[model samples]
Target chain A: MKRLMNRRPNRASKIFLGLLPFIIILLVYASASSQRLAENADDKLLPSFSSMADAINRMAFQEDKRTGQYLFWTDTWSSLKRLLTAVFFAAVIALSLGILLGVIPYLHANFSPLITVISLIPPMAILPILFIVFGLGELSKVVLIGIGITPFITRDLLARVLEIPQEQLIKAQTLGANTWLVITRIVFPQVCPRLIDALRLSLGAAWLFLIASEAIAADGGLGYRIFLVRRYLAMDVIIPYVVWVTFLAFMTDYLLRKFSKFAFPWYYQASNKA
Target chain B: MSILLEIKNVWKQYGDAVVLEQLSKCVSAGEFVTIVGASGCGKTTFLNMLLGTESYSKGKILLDGKPLPSEPSQDRGVVFQRYSAFPHLTVLRNTMLGAELSASPFLGIVFNRRKFSAIREKAEKMLESVGLSHALNSYPHELSGGMQQRLSIAQALMKQPRMLLLDEPFGALDPGTRSDMHKLILALWKETGITIFMVTHDIEEGFYLGTRLWVFDKVRFDPHNAEAYGAQITYDIDVDQSAKRRLKKELELELEKSEQAFGASE
Candidate 1:
């Protein structure tokens, strides 16, 4: 019965379910704000109008009322889009660099200490230098996150690559495996899952740095938008942006972990036994 | 009978200490020869010599009428006390590697499903011979000690080597598994018709496994002790002198005891 119930969701169902909750939430908030406006406008025309919701709804839409109330939502989307793009680019560049640095023997050995020491320093410690050199632009922001994320992923993967057993190497050797075959067929497969875990860990750091990235110099990201709203002392927009960034970060982290679980089930399953 | 593999007055040393001193032995093809002794008697050194891995300080050795080479090859398969296989590779791949190398170009070509299928089929046949057909896809770490050793045996036989050298192969296994493995090995040797040379300290293990067994004295002897004695080395001279005489006397006593014991046991 469980197997029968496990029929995969259709593409249409997946899209609908994906968009359903956000659409409903947007409608609810927009309607609540819209209704509040209608009630307040009518209250001004009449006398003896008293509802505690008027104060709360006015507070909710306070920042949105600055321009067209819908601009608030658009600004939030634009900010998320900018940061997600930064994250996407950072993740791609960082994972590639990480895999390369992690696998190369000379690079891993020679620069591992430097990489360890580099990851230890806080992102902001270098943020000022990065801002000075790259001048608080988009380049500096993305590059900063990429630089920070690369070592985190690569070092973890290098440690994992080192941990594959000597017996495994001997087994390959006695079996007549060539050096390249041993690395590709044996080492790669064994380390691939661990690399995935390291990549996921780097993704979390990338999100963190992306927010801190807007701290450098940016017209609009979740970070910049948070600071922008802070000027007006509007906690409402800031709170929502915080919530959205948290949700996005959680979703990405959760999905990567889930994908790894599905892709390399043996790795985690076997380890969890002991 | 023609000599198949011969170790002629071979000497092996581990650092300053000699393990095998001018040891000589010959094993014809299809013969089963076992070396028996107490621990550290250099029986394993003899097996290593046949496998062409251990270097001797002096003398010559031959395998199948050829001078033993510098390096051991797939022509000789060795099963050690511990199973040796890549923990990453599946058993089928492990077995296939032994057979595939040193053959025709057909052997070198992998990833061709047809060729791999054939080698895999042969590997399966070998695994079944050793009762490990169920573990074809399993890695080394997944196997039990006995199963791993069986896999090691199967792995060695995959190449159909001219000789198989086992150095206390079943020593690490439990008694029940050891007995089972011994029987299985004997059956394998009988079926395969390859020469078998093994070293074992366990008397019953040596007895049960080898068709021809050579027992070494429990203590190694040095004849030059008396010639080198000095005032400072007086105790060494006395101990070596007494030890030498005692060893000869002990051998005589042991021979008498063995004969009597054999007569009684029979």
Candidate 2:
């Protein structure tokens, strides 16, 4: 049989490659837990997979006595809503302002310095300020995420917009496109996929802000649940919650990548050239 | 034929550096004019001035005996060396852009069923004429150099401008592709009878395509104050008498003699 020089691995092998790391981590944890349990039959730090699985099942499927709602599902929903809302607002604002700054010289000259200054300020430093101004409710948490990630998104998108070739702009003008027309037909389409990419890069910061806010004051969120479990030395709940948050973040990033690829195949095609 | 474009005693300067001085030329209706010059000879500067994108320091450009506007207009369509077609649009959409833009409102082009079909039909016809019917769905980057140039020409002509400006439009193509482009351009010129003003460094291309060829170079340069001088029209030949085959040698001799006489070896 003839074999290609750079053949791709089969799907089964690829899946196994992806799962290899998690399997290693689980085996290591299980071995450590067994060693600890053999010495002292009451070790909480390294609970076995069965105990962790049981804890997740009860949290996800069983109703809580106090709230009469599945805490895990409720926490996931609340955290997702805040993160998505903040991310949505940040994307819209950044795309609009970034493109405006990039296209119009006058606006750029006037506003770029201010945006740069604001971007330089660390977002975490303002978490307390956000809570004070917006109150310790959902508004504060969402706004914290927005403030935390908007600057990064705006700067990234601004660079992308600026990177568009001067020839394209002049060509658009020669095609009888006015300022507004150029923005809509040329700049708008090119910047959209870049905005999605910028959003994906900023998602990590978004999650960080969401978790920090929830850990500080929220009653129902993934971060809040993790911190609450920490006080009781409930390592099982803490570890499972952390894993679930990671899984959710990974899914969001994956879906966004797929969406951008499907939405702007031309952009991807040009970029992926050899 | 009446004069369609007249440039009278035009002078251009950039800060203290003079680029063009007392440049006077005119193109009659339906005439094809090709401009050739060495680098830094203000050929592109003159072309931009004609397009009305760059403001001349001192002069008036009259189109149809009326002063041309100071900004780009649909009356003049320009095709650059490359990057002419919008990268994001497919070949068909690139051609359709002009018609759709003129038909649609200022804010945006409303894509109605009837207008869209009509515009599509017109664009398809133009694409077919330019020999890009098979690449209707291909993006600009997907096409070869020759195909991209053809698509850009189609895109420019779709607007039905009175004058087409070509700035080294085929400079980047290989020799074979360049000759094919020459044929395409001549056919389009003869068919439409639209006026053309092309700037090129290729001396042969300028002579082959132009009915009236203009040679531009810096006639007056000071070694100490070089920036004070600017290029002028050194030769304006009516190529109707020079047969296409013989023109190359004849012009080569002419250019060599002029270079020796003026000590402008470049």
Candidate 3:
């Protein structure tokens, strides 16, 4: 039975990657809240920004310069923090679930209509229900982020999954391998190109969602800072934030592309173009 | 030799289109049997039934004594015509997949490096035997068609299966490569006393590889296909030919006589 059971649990970078959000969240929080380490700002961190919009507003302003919109580089770094968190989380979830569903046809079929409906709903449409259900928490925003980004990510993953050469599966089975081995040993590895593509896709959507999210919510975050400056029409601050988001997203994409190239050197010659 | 593998009264159909009818064959241990038939004559269907891929409407296939499952495991390894090895994994991994797939699933996760390091070493040695050692880290796309088939053979053999099932493993290769692979398979058979069940359309290939060959010349009396394989066609030839073509004529006559001796259509 054990032979039948026990797929490799998450290990290596996959485990590090799976927990990355929590780590990065803490890192960003510590760094951003460091200058505001006064007991007052520290206490407010948990209570503030119940949702994506609330978080953005926190970055915008609230009479305190420590946590509020600042002159130049500070605002840039604050906005970069918000963008990176959203992008990294969005990219990971989308690529993971999207590729999973995309590669497994039965999963794709079972969730196909629901995924379509999920996509049709505006990316930000779920926040109201999110607020009611989760009651002003990060769950709503995170789930929303996952859903919003997954559609495009899933589409890309499905394309990549389909791109896997059928011959490989046939060959594995011919060699006396059961079904699961084919997925782990063959389909999964072969789908790296699509996984990379899906990561890039979700990353782009995450940035867009982050902006929209910060637009409506309550507290501190890069999006909130942008809206803060929006009242003052501070295009200068917005310019830096926009420039940094673009740069960060580009960096995420460039880094992932490089990683995929190095990790799966065989993808360079894949007959199936994803 | 206890009929190492047996196909009994096999009939197959894809939907309403019938592909095989009452086909039966018995292969002995340490024997190489090749099936030859015209296009759509159920040659592959017979092979599929033996390997337990396609179902037989009314037949039972036995390996040793137990019934063959829906998917045959370890008992048979097939080499497909296309480049079927996973390109993402190296040739070593591909060959090792046979052994890897059969081991405890946890073994794949725990002690992975240890498991793979050993399997990989064994696979590299198998590749060396097949003349594909240089492709140890190379992907299937990196190797030539002949090399891929050899890798496929190595993969099949890694499991140490009792029989190797080849579905035109070399059909996609060039003429030279095809013969080369045939020689490799033959040599491997001589080295290991395993049975080989191969399918081929190349007439010369069948003669070269098979100990006992069956040819479907559309000459059999098929009660189901009266209008199609209908009455057999008989050809008239001058047995006494001019001296100009004597040698080739004798060879052709000998071939025809053997075909008749093996129950060819009148």
Candidate 4:
């Protein structure tokens, strides 16, 4: 007889095991919703699935009477635009600054402590300051997300650059590479894949900062709509918006991982120990 | 042959701990110099100095009577024991890296298609010479240890360097692969007539591969403070065929006694 710890599930059983908890949670929610609805027809806490479905259709398919726009699509588009713009700028800054700090001792000595201090400072604590300086507009939201994740990503990329074996750098120099050449030829290509990985890890934090900023001050965004509906206790709309945001985050991570594997196959090969 | 390199009383120290002291030697052109020593005897430090990756505390090194550059340059090539090849590059790209860097100093890339193809062709020839033609498109991680070393050798040779520094290049290979690599390296050395400096832990390998064998040892040991003294070149023996045959037995016995002493100290 195999011990419990030694027992391994096959592929089909593993999939079944993974879905068991989600299924149980959904069942629990359905029963609770039915019980609450039985007592009061206007229970706002956990609206029945049908009401949530109607809410989704109204928000996504029907045009708003006031704005004459499909709220769901407009909010998603504006949110994604801000998030992607912030992330793009953050990635560029992280790669260039990370490589500079890692390779040059003079820069490292001067700036490493400063980066460490910046990373230690809570990004959320500076939100009000950002809003005041950049104004309560798209710029503030974008800057919030950028500031929230750039230091972390830069630190991650700097560690990756430093983790490169000293032998490789020496070999590059022996191969007639000057400092700039080494950065472009050896360090840049190697760090690009790691930069993708860092971006994937920081995406969750980026979304958090984006939502917090949008909830405070935004004309149109997913977070703005959620916060706006919260005033009326509209859990149906909020729940769907939260799930959509999660799905979008998952898709971004999945795409970035796939792109890294495709563009830098050697990185995966080396890291996988194949 | 004229002296290609001269070391004038070079000393290397890291703060209070001295590594090498008063090392002076002249290496002629086309000489195969193999260095053997006990662990922590500064042999790798000496090799790093020759490779220009480490700076000595005193004295100087001259290449063709000119002061050797403090930093590594194209005239010298080095292959470390492991991780000599870039993990991100295919074998062909790794081999072409030196040529591309030399051709485009700033960019380290050949933008012209015809020029890029010429570099690629030269890289293919270099890889073929090292018997890695089939694995040109493969990443370094895909190759076995022996094949990786061969790729490193090919990469080092791409610049047509005048001096080749190999730091225990075959140390990580199995016995069978090590022997094969020995034959390959000896053939390459014979054909290219490049000056070679190799550091190895195996005395027998030193005797077999080198025209001159250098032994580094500590003459003075401080019981209270180990860093008080540094290692020096204690023995420099010419390795002719007759001397190799005669001295091999003596060195093996000496190595055994030293190993026993080292074990007892532990």
**Candidate rank order under TM-score:** 4, 2, 3, 1
Clashing pairs in 4: none
lDDT of 3 by residue, A138-241 (tens): 45555666667767766666677666666555567766556566666666666667667676766777767766666677355556667876785554455555
Model 3 alpha-carbon drift over 4 Å, by segment: A1-109, A174-176, A271-274, B107-117, B217-266
Candidate 2: where are CA atoms >4 Å away?
A1-18, B241-266
RMSD of each: 11.9, 3.1, 13.4, 1.9
| Candidate 1 ranges with C-alpha deviation above 4 Å | A1-124, A127-143, B1-110, B135-143, B161-169, B194-203, B211-266
The models' CA-based lDDT, in order, is 0.65, 0.87, 0.66, 0.92
- Model 3, residue A137: distance off in Å is 4.0
Scored against the true structure, residue A239 in model 4 reaches a CA lDDT of 93
- DockQ for every model comes to 0.13, 0.60, 0.37, 0.86
Q: Please list, in the order the candidates appear, how each scores on TM-score for chain B only.
A: 0.79, 0.92, 0.80, 0.94
Give the alpha carbon lDDT tens digit for every residue of B15-96 in model 2: 9989899988888989999998767678899998888878898878899999987878788888889878877889998998
TM-score of each: 0.60, 0.93, 0.74, 0.96
Please tell me which predicted candidate would have the highest TM-score against the true structure.
4
lDDT of 3: 0.66
Q: How do the residues B33-98 of candidate 3 rate in per-residue lDDT, one tens digit apiece?
A: 776655555667777767667788777777886677666566777777776677766888777877
* Candidate 3 all-Cα RMSD: 13.4
- DockQ, candidate 1, vs. native dimer: 0.13
- Give me the displacement of residue B185 in model 3, in angstroms: 1.2
Model 4 whole-model lDDT (C-alpha atoms):
0.92
TM-score of chain B, candidate 3?
Answer: 0.80
